[model samples]
Structure formats: structure tokens, C-alpha cells
Target: MKEKHEIGALILRVVLGLIFIGHGTQKFQGGIENIAGWFDSIGLPGFLAYIVASLEVVGGIALILGLATRVVGGLFVLLLLGAIIKVQLAVGFIGGYAYDLALLTISLFLLMNGSKLYSLDKLLFKAKNN
Candidate 1:
């Protein structure tokens, strides 16, 4: 049923949001410069790493609060796509690529569907209607 699907999607959104927020928190603990340094060490553009880290942190918050869920999800999909192409694909599915792939799929789904019932988005919609 539609209700069941909505509940499942909400659970997925919360879990994914928490995981992203946790990783972002690690980055913030040492600040964006630290993350940028790590990216530079890997031969990546340091500024871009900061951008990705910011997106993960702020986007995770957006998702957790169900605010602008589609926009955040879409941004995350782009972020994950970059990760998959830049890092995971060459390494193959051996070292946790499966998990990343699953997350990417879920993010894409969220982008398409947006937050469901009981979310801030849903409440906003209802408030506007009423």
C-alpha cells in the first residue's frame, strides 16, 4: 500500500541522513581545511573537497529535517555519482562499493520521490493547503 511505501521511504531517508551526517561530523571535527588537505593528498582539488563536505553536512541536515528533501537528495546523488566514478569504479565492487551503490540508488529515489508523510515537507504542504 501507499502508506507502507511512504513509511519505508521515510525510514530509509532517516538512516541515510544519519549516516551522511555522521561522516560530515567527522570532517567538521577537524574543519574543512583538514578535509581539503586529505583531498589534496589524494591529488584531488582541495576546494572541491570542501564543496562536497559542505554538501554532505548541510544536505544531511536538510534530509533529516525533511526540508528541501528533493534538492538535497539530488545534490547527494550528484555527489555519490562523482564518488562512484572518481573512486569506486576503478576499485571495482570489492571494497564497499556495494554499500555505496545502494546509497546512491536510494538517494536517487529520494530525489525523485521527495519526502513522504510525517515529514516537514509534508507538514508544510498540508499547512499551505489548509
Candidate 2:
């Protein structure tokens, strides 16, 4: 296997997508209403639960497909930041912000790098470096 950053980006994109997909699916499986109530308890609007869940699932799919990579990355960054600030910060690094920070870093990478090669941006948009 060649050690190409494109391949690495692809792997990162897919894995991140899978993680978000699983989380989003879990939210639905556990009941959107319950998630909504939890969101309200956390000082966020209950409707946000549906939006977040939808973003996670839809954005994850978009990531895997290499579509709108930068856009999806930006959304992920915002979501992670919100999670860290609104909830995970209280739990401390061991079980909270650490993982979120990692995800945020990856999101930042995707935002900055724009999925590198092997992406829709490159294929369809004819992005020079993406």
C-alpha cells in the first residue's frame, strides 16, 4: 500500500463518517423524543436534537461519498465545538473533551485540506488541490 495522503484522507473521511453515522443512528434508535428532552435539559432547544441528528447522519454520508467535503467538515467542527463547550467540558479530558478534540482536529484538517484527492470536489468541481 502506498503511503499517500490522499489515501489517508480517504480513510479518515470514511472512518469519521462511520462514527457520526453510528452516533446518529444510535440517537434515533434510542428515541428522538428522548434525545430532544435531553437537549432541552442541557439548555439547548429541543428541536436542535432533530437537526443535529439529521446533520450527523446526512453529513456522515456526505463525508463518505466525498461530497461537499469542506462544507461537511465545517459543520462537524461546529458540532464538536458546541459539544465540547456545552457538555463535554464538564466531564474533563479523560472521557470527554479528549475524544472531541481529536474529532475537532480532524474536522479542522478536512476543512483546511478539503479532502485532498479522491473526492468529489476534485472530480466534479475540478478543484486544483482538493
Candidate 3:
């Protein structure tokens, strides 16, 4: 059971990491100016586009490497929350919010559980069972 649980976490982490990385790359390739313009159109600070993009890229890498899982997951949750509020909410549930909600739930799970097996967190922060 424990092994299965760890494997599940590993799968979830990698999938989520890849998804975030892809989204981040899209934001970049789509042009920061365009994204910032979209952000401004949505009544958000344009500068935030850059910040969010950087976070997604860096956080995605952290997730993929299983480094600082709790921290990265927490940040991802916050980011998703912002997306839900600023964009997904306007799109309505079936339109888009459901996806952000799912991502938020997954991020929350990772935040609470941290990395399991096959993670740098496990290797570097192994508990000393004295």
C-alpha cells in the first residue's frame, strides 16, 4: 500500500510539473507583451504576467526534480487560486474553472504530502531514526 501510494505521488508530481512547464513555455513563446496585455485587459497589473510566468517555469522545474515539493506546491496553489479568481471564474465552471480547480486540488495534495519516494526531498531530508 505504501509503495503504491508513493508511486501515485510520483506520477502526479511529474504530470503536474509537465503541465505547468508547458503552460509557462506557452506564455513565454506567446510573447510577454501579449500576455501582459491580456492581463491588463483583465484588470490585473501587467507586470504580474512576468512574475507568474517565472514562477510557473521555476516551480514546474522544482516539481519535476522533486525538490522543495512543499514550497513549490504551495506556490502553485496560490498561483492557481489567482487564476481561478482572475480568469477561470469569468469563464464559468464548465468552461474553464473546473480545470483550475482540479489543479488546485492536486497542488494542495502535494503541499500537504510533500515528496514521497524517488524524490530529492526524500534523499536529502531523510529522517534519522535514532
lDDT of 2 at 35: 98
TM-score of 2: 0.91
Clash pairs for candidate 3: none
TM-score to native of every candidate shown? 0.88, 0.91, 0.93
Ranking by lDDT: 2, 3, 1
lDDT computed for candidate 2: 0.89
Q: How close to the true structure is residue 1 of candidate 1, measured as C-alpha lDDT?
A: 90
Candidate 3, 1-130: lDDT as tens digits: 8888888888889888998998888999999899999999989999999999988888898898898888999999999999999888988999889999998998998999876667887777778312
Candidate 1: where are CA atoms >4 Å away? 127-130
After superposition, the stretches of candidate 2 with alpha carbons farther than 4 Å from their true spots are 1-3, 127-130
The whole-model lDDT of each prediction reads 0.82, 0.89, 0.88
Q: Order of candidates by TM-score, top first?
A: 3, 2, 1
TM-score between model 1 and native = 0.88
lDDT of 3 at 30: 90
Q: Could you give candidate 1's per-residue lDDT for residues 7-77 as a string of tens digits?
A: 87888788888888887878878787988887888778899877787788888887888888888888888
Task: Write model 2 residue lDDT over 91-113, tens digit each, in one string.
Answer: 99999899999999888888887
Candidate with more favorable, higher lDDT: 1 or 2: 2
- Candidate of highest lDDT: 2
Better of 1 and 3 by TM-score: 3
